[model samples]
Target: MASLVKKTKKPALQPLSFHSHPTMPPPPQTTLSTVLHLVLFLLLSSTTTAISTSQDTSDLEQDCTNKWIHIRDLPPQFNLDLLKNCSEYPLFDNFCSYLSNHGLGQKTYNDSHSWYRTDPFMLELIFHRRMLEYPCLTSDPNLANAIYLPYYAGLDSLKYLFGPAVNSSFLHGLDLFHYLAHQDSESIWHKNFGHDHFLVMARPAWDFCQPLSNDPPIFGTSLLELPEFYNVTMLTFEARAFPWQEIAIPYPTSFHPSNLALFEAWINRLRRTRRSTLMLFAAGGGISANPNVRRSIRLECDNSTNVSLNGSITMKYAKLCEFVDCSNGICEHDPIRFMKPMLQASFCLQPPGDTPTRRSTFDGILAGCIPVFFEELSAKKQYKWHLPEEKYEEFSVFIPKEEVVFKGLKILDVLMSIPRAEVRRMREKVLEMIPRVMYRKHGSSLGLRSKKDAFDIAIDGTLQRIKSRLEDSA
Candidate 1:
């Protein structure tokens, strides 16, 4: 039993196997340096991966910043569904069918975007079609910088208000709400609450904001007020203040030239012509909420009637809606005569309609006539996105609405006081501005193929705004 075994010497430390127990202890001191080296190697790899990821994200953002817009491929039903009943409204009944001709109605072959007045409701169609024809549109979401939501929210709501449905605004609104809410979980709008998304409409913002019980039934819904729409930007015909979510866009007009050459030719012809009238007031200021403002305008115009200013610009007046037949939601006057007043007048009166904005302002601009605004709300703050940032006095005349109303200030005198040379300069400015305000019959109206026109400017301006907002958030 005492014949026993021999003992061998053992080292104090040894390399540890990674395949040790779950709560493995530290490696032996002899292997500690190796463990530290391994840790450093892994850390470098992770850091490299992270830097690469950051670079990729930055590249994507920069690319988007340069004019990449992703259009949501919405279900066809969303666009075409309401279009079935589109013509139910009197003003826009023919517009839905005229999309093929660029909303030119039956006058598509008129060799120019003239003759027939373009219905204002053509906006929803125009903006949607513009995106389809734009250079910045991207089908791939990953490559997109901003998202476009082509909901036709204006036309969709207006049909109910102006159609036989009567107060059925909620019908389409509820449907739209559910449609947005039930989108695929991966939808960008679903997660971001549509912050990067935008929709353009021809209607005012008031139509989308739901009214109170005592509020006038404008046939609207709570779509804009809903929590889902808080982050989305709105391009509207007339954007009111307070929420500051909406921006004003110009109303649709009849002069949608196919090419810049043609547009320039038309403008040059107008510039060459002489304006015989100092100011022309075609609309009646007969009766409104504030009757005095309009009545005074009527009285001033009447007093100045048939009187030539400085023996060059005569003052003329007419009541458009009453004398002109606009029964079909468009005036049926001879195209030549209709535009004559605007074209002959050096400055055309642009008073407020139901809203602060008026299509007449744009009409006068297209006619190569400077706009004369009585209400600041009419054009001053309404078109900040589209107009030049120049002072109002440069392109328009602002005879204080109250001054003209109560004090009986002479509009003719105020206009005559400005030098005739200055008036010529103002007219030239309006001629240059024609392209910016007009929606072309074709996207390539200017010299460049697919040159940006009104539609392009509006969309691009909105995208720039969206980028700024995102940066602020970050």
Candidate 2:
């Protein structure tokens, strides 16, 4: 898969405090595009050898048909059956919804020229479909580098997690383990003890960890807890510290560029667009028991709004009590209503939600907005595969939640104190990250000038990890 790159053991990050150093001197001023150019130059140089001008599906298919990765074509019970009914996908008696525009959902927003608001939970469907378009896909296991288990484990487990009748009896989880147990030396599981195998899930690590642990006893399953999964890689939205490595991936956003032109247009637009709002927080509050600092930050944003600053600090959809229905990858496909605020904001406040990590972090970064993080684990501790091995302040703004709640620190002033040049530099860094953090719809070909995107990085990193692990064992 790859030669050698350290894939295990990520060093802990020193917590960054975005101090309101009013007298802080600005670093050397660099144009936003210059930073972009430097970053792209480094990346392009590294990947120039692998970047092909025309990697059409036909060539990739022919090349990989018997020499890349083999996909296990499971029965309807594994994948197809889950998608047969959109309503029952998350639950048996769920909402009846139709998927238009090839599972991206019908574009309800008027602004088709710029961006569209797509559902967040459709990642499982999107990824599974996109996997078919992967150049490394092969039907024959005989000529394969690794094996892909295209199981809708996240979708399948969602039923048990959100169902009305909950129990520890996860039939789907048990059934999968039983199937794996029956594998012989000819099976992919027998190939290096399933070290070269992987499966992608749209949900976080907690969804699968939960085994009806709540006092009221919400539905939870024990799928990942099974001993059989210890050797296999689990690709999830938020990677957990399990026996085997769990890879973190960006949540599926509305913007899935079909071509390089569209991708370039989006990045250029973000670079030139004038951000009217100083900071915006689009997260919901009062969703959990403690609700943590969300409620506090929401109040602060509400109190600090001003017309003169052109909506300096804004908060939207703060409480998500009614948002439980869409928790299982079944959200309204359109997200532009929420995305507009992100597009207009200079900095987006991203606090720790149910977990330290939030999908909105990627959304804010993709929208070219500098993110303000409260916790180290949100992006710093997590996303080792996607984020750089450097301090969090390089691409994001970090202020401890205590300062906003008790220390009486003004987030707006703190962020505004940052030099304009530094802000542009950070925003440019965020824009430069678009290609790496986003998942392009790589149908048939990786498209023209396909700069290494989130999909490319994730796959390449996982492959190298496997190779490194196998070699160490050897």
Candidate 3:
């Protein structure tokens, strides 16, 4: 089957407190008799009006504060059937394995606290499970502030991506929209024409967008172009600059902590780990549509050391760099292998792969290795809701791709030039960003110490965006 499996594009690379005040007493009954009675009635009427207004305001505040998410009861075909029939498809030959543990993949090892072999393609499942555990989920659609479409769009696209029929690529998505359009007039999609509804697309947005004539014809579907989905928000791993409907989210990493304590412990481990190597690059170079960047990085790795054809850097000739050569495509499926190298390195090289983004970027952050970006869209242009745009330099370094790939600039020189104190500061900022870039276990509870993780940030951002969109239209 030509190993239809994609060579893992290894990267290179607040609580509200309510206070109530007691109502003031009405003026004492003055002894004007009839005048007094009339004045008393007026005062009481005004007081009642004030009380009613206050109650309405309180109700409004409560509603505004609670972010209610309603999951649609989509037909099993849109979600469950995809899983049930996963084993039948050659494209999904190993897909069923990733469905374990609520789509967080298998555990890295027995008794491992916060690690998983998460597949980047399994995001919709993780998100669906997390949405199920959402604190403010509502059973009634009318009561929901945001609607969640529980369709496994990512999984559903596999057949199209791998099938021989290019023209049939969009049929399933078309059927999905048709199904949605046929729903009752009062259904969620009909309400605002799905403006407030959102779906998680584990793949990049381009997979669902219309492909250009010169582009690879078998790459994607026309789902993104369908009018039925125009207003629907898409939470994807990568998003385009236009179509503000798509929001880029952090790619799922190997770390899925069970609670806040474990999350904190992981950060602490990253802080205390001793990094001996100046930089690490763990990604595949054999199979990628976009190989120029990795080729440049691999060339640097090879020329710097007596690298074997396998691309491994033997310590005999190794100096400032370490390469976990993934040319065979192993690290893409098992990211844990990259962990040891990343933990021992001060910086993780994150060059764009098949797309502008790489799963290794999140993995690098998780390991507390400051990321070095060769492309602006790789990190700076995405994840606005999770990563602070103003704080990129605090945690990451940017060296333009042209400098290294075309100009032959040494990545080591730029990194070594950074002061140790500044490096430490950057590492600290990277650690601070750990929680925001990960998706904690769906049901994980951290009590009073709980911080907002990726899932929380995504839902909040979606709701806020939907609210603004609704208001603008209103």
Better of 2 and 3 by lDDT: 3
- On residues 257-305, what C-alpha lDDT tens digit does candidate 1 reach at each position? 5655555556666867667666776554444456555566566666664
Residue-level lDDT of model 3, residues 316-393, one tens digit each, is 123577888776556765555677678888899998877889888998998889999998888788889999789998
Model 2 misplaced regions, further than 4 Å = 1-67, 89-102, 109-117, 169-172, 183-185, 211-218, 241-243, 286-291, 305-332, 442-449
| Superior candidate under TM-score, 2 versus 3 | 3
Off by over 4 Å in 3: 1-66, 164-166, 211-216, 286-291, 305-318
Q: List per-prediction Cα lDDT, in the order shown.
A: 0.61, 0.60, 0.72
Residue pairs in collision within model 3: 12-349, 12-350, 13-349, 13-350, 13-351
- Clashes counted in candidate 3 amount to 5
Worst 10 residues of 3 by lDDT: 11-20
Please give the range of 10 consecutive residues that has the lowest summed lDDT in model 2.
Answer: 10-19
Evaluated against the true structure, the overall lDDT of model 1 is 0.61
- The digit string of per-residue lDDT tens for model 2 on 1-474 reads 110011113211111111122243322223334434433442343233223422447766665433366666555577556654445434333322323333343333332422333455556555655555565654446556667776878767756666543554345466765675574436656657767777887678766665433455444565666666766777788766533557787776666666665566567667776687777777565344453577666655666634234222233222211111224333234344345566677888888877778777888888898888997777776777788758467778999888877777767668767877888888888887787777665352345336877766777777777767767767
